[model samples]
Target: MTNNKNQNLLLRSEHVWKVFGDGNEKKTILKDMSMSVHEGEFVAILGPSGSGKSTFLRVLSGLIPPTEGHVYMHEKELQGINNEVSIVFQNFALYPWLTVRKNVALGLLHSTISEEEKEKRITDAIHAIGLKGFDDAFPREISGGMKQRVGFARALVVQPTILMMDEPFSALDVLTAENLRHELLTLWLEKKIPTKTIIMVTHNIDEAVSMADKVCILSSNPGEIRVELEGLPVETRMQKGSDHTELVDSIYQIMTNPKKNPQTILHDGNHIPITLEESPYQVLPQIGISKLKAYIKKLMLQGGKESIRELNTNISLDDLLPLIEMMDILGLGGVEENRLFLTELGDAYAHGNTEEEKQILKKQLIANVSLIQFIMQQLEDGKHTIHTSDVLKHLHAYFPHQDAIIQLKTALTMGIYAGLFSYNRQTGRISLIEN
Candidate 1:
């Protein structure tokens, strides 16, 4: 709920750095980041996958302490679980055994408010969130949408000064998510809830643009703030106007290719382009060679050429971006402006159903990916054998432990599909496949 007179600064972060691991394996998730949230504003932290949007939100909310720097509420240092805030998670995160009314009570578990007030709050919250009749229902009995409604009620029942959501609608289907987005915005704009401010983390461009009063775009891999956008008229929001379309396009461009100068594009001279110095770590996007081949086959099925919009159909931006980006990175796919182009090798692979595709992909990986080259050399040096854990530990020099494990998994998938390596999942070992 917005209050024009309550325009005072509510919360802010200063030089915050969130690092995981220690010593030589240390990886910084957020680097020297600082931002502010004022009263009566909906702020969206938007970024790509592995940009640490969730990590940053946890740090901002004081759910976890930052490794360096401070978060201040009203200019005072915040310590351990910001009491004024409440969060709704991406997953419903409800207790299956608890009834809706009882589940909502968890928000008041630490509050000193009397039992009568707590009951009234629960009743009001359940009604306001459109789950009035579901008070006695268990989470297992409700629809996915209703489960999420209960999530919102629990967060709001606390009467928080600041409300935060981490991809709250991500788990819902398209129609349900759209409906919830509208409902929440109505509640905030109509002042139905007591929350003075709202902060959300999302990878969706349209969701951020439609919902947020201020949009802070974040760059991946160290998750730096790329730009802060504001001043869109409230009336212009959610409207299918030129302004809305243009804003979405510009944001899409920035998200897709962060290095391009925003001011020079389309001769507008009125945009803020992202300009982060990309790190050297190889972020092997989780889409492996088999999936890549499937996409290529799909593209060939459509036609030799498909518009970007056509390819993006039925897929969310977060999932689709990594896949197309990986293809471009591996020199198998090309996107120039709005059109998608398949490489000659990619075309041939699409046409062939046999080992010809694997042979072509092997040559492509060896020529393009340095990580593949490094892994191949290690296999040769280790007498054509190595433990997957050993390679994972070696990768920790580049990524955090969890991320390094995922990188190894993606690389292994690519190596297997390319016929360049053999991996025994049962034994957790990798061996070279010399011709």
Candidate 2:
């Protein structure tokens, strides 16, 4: 962590903690997290949904303060918004009424610099981000790729010491995203932009591996630094070699196995075991029963067990991880040594008829899932039906604010599928079907 560039200590988190809301609904988003960035580095914060990757990035840039800890920039504790950092948002945050040049100029709106200096910086930024001819183009007049270029231009026009991006390419088309990444890397690696450091937050493991000098992964249920590793070489990250493939495969294992203290991959050629905290109140994956059945059948087709990485060839990591974790929770199946397999109950359910499948799921849900049990108790305590909002209040205490509603939807998906609860979609009521 030495800074050999003879520059300032760019950024660091000191036992950072972030909590949202208060009372029972208050959820701790980060816990005792400590990390640092040096000058001349592109660091990526990598994690799943609700892992506080975006929140951590905001704290690092001094957009928000940690509830209980500290964020430091240039070796001094930061109190408010750090003027040295610029954020390239996930959504292109251009003013709809403004032309590209006008939007880029907004970056310097409050500066005391002369209009002459402002115009030069604006022109330079637009040209550097490949938006020279599009200065007069309004946001609606440009394509998604061009709009993001305008975003980069706006951030660059500030000429800040640190540039932070939050999933900058996630909103673009595949080819356009690829082109933008190449352009952005040129700006960073070739020093085309005046920024001394870059910090980005992303959920894509390959994106982190390919773009960053350092990649720090955060684990969920009160996000903490799970592991930090130096990124792979550019040639190795071209996604054409065995090294790239193997490293990506290893990362997939580490991410999907979060409930355990997963012994993860190599760091700078040395193997390390990062003991991560377990997520006890793990949120349900936003998926349906049909996908679960199909995956179970797929597992059986593979002779009851297969490498999860191989099984995930056509599926996204976001979808696959939740599905596997759901199976593990239900006693239907689990992962062992990086392989996914059906438990005895799962095998029986896989072979069972439709009625038998529901019965097995009912038994598992009743025994293992507390959320389902809570719903049944609620119905028994007062009435046969409960408003979804009432249960959502309980859910919000455990999950992120944005994901609380999703947790309810997913809970009901499994609950209704197992015949434990009946949901009224129009009325937003959940009734106990069995108790």
Candidate 3:
């Protein structure tokens, strides 16, 4: 759905700065941020909570104006009446007492247009969102998923040129969220609205990868654009496999590693090569599980005395499992009392291929915390310890990622065992330790 003429840049933001409060109390959310989206492109803003993703969207949607910088649509400066923009919020924001039809029609009320036109728009929106049969149902009468559909319908009724969704699917159940995401992807692909542009804000890395043509990752604190990743979101997930595992590992590295640049040595006796500002995924140390397995095999065959831990020290359970699993999968390494040990295959590589193996042994042991922190990040400020389910709900407010929540539960279990917290899985009750 690209605008053929001036399709190069549908939306552009220059040095955007959103500040809150005043005088000494001022807080700058965005700092000198600049980016552009082409017409019909699904661009996603990926960041932790309080990273100013919502602020960016609000300014783009004309709900709030930026304190600094300017935004342009079709190369024209955007001011008040940017009619081509529409938004769907995470809270559903549907009128509880109003039926789906009326809720969707509320957006059209400001227009002087006749009721017939409004009805036609509302009906079309409902049908497009696959909620045709739920037109007469109130928000409470429908399921959470359907209520979100009403929200989408409400936004879609306006038929804006640009669609802004701030974690719109984050309120639904796991299955429902996945279903709605799939539906939206299908709609975007099939409909191909030429004037359409989508800018979605989400904390879920997978969602950004799954639906966006461009994924913009934001840094913390004074939220600023950190990096932009481009790739096609695979329609089907292949868990525990090389392709899938590699992508996940790469993303994890980019998000976690602080000192990303690393020194490297090649087989040609090249010593201390500098890698400047490369995506953590592209660095040799952060190679995928499958590639790591292959490299280990090659190194073992080379047969040289070298410490494996020195080469690869900063590996976490989450990213390291797949690598070890690959060793088991390929029959290259053996497990000894819950530890991974070099087998005949590994011993062979470690002995002979000193330099070549050294190249492969470069490891980035960037310390990363449990995935629970990622979920906790989605929550607003609160002091009380929350149940696992409640924590999951907070996660939904940003990224609707149930899998990450599961990881958080696993982390919580570990934390409990470490005396950091107390938990009972069966009851799902959790309490923080004073220490």
Top model number, lDDT = 2
lDDT of 3 by residue, 68-87 (tens): 99988888888975778878
Which runs in model 3 stand beyond 4 Å of their true positions? Answer: 1-6, 192-195, 233-245, 259-435
Clashes of each: 0, 0, 17
For the record, the alpha-carbon RMSD of candidate 2 to the native fold, in angstroms, is: 4.7
lDDT of 1 by residue, 185-257 (tens): 8888888998999999998778888888888888766788877776355667766588876676666666655
lDDT of 2 by residue, 164-283 (tens): 999999999889988899888877776778798889999887778778877788877668888777676654554547877666766777787766544533434453346654444556
Task: Name the weakest run of 10 consecutive residues (lDDT summed) in model 1.
Answer: 262-271
What TM-score against the true fold does each predicted structure earn? 0.80, 0.81, 0.59
Clashing pairs in 2: none
Worst ten-residue run, lDDT, model 2? 1-10
- What C-alpha lDDT do the candidate models reach, one value each? 0.81, 0.82, 0.62
lDDT of 2 at 376: 78
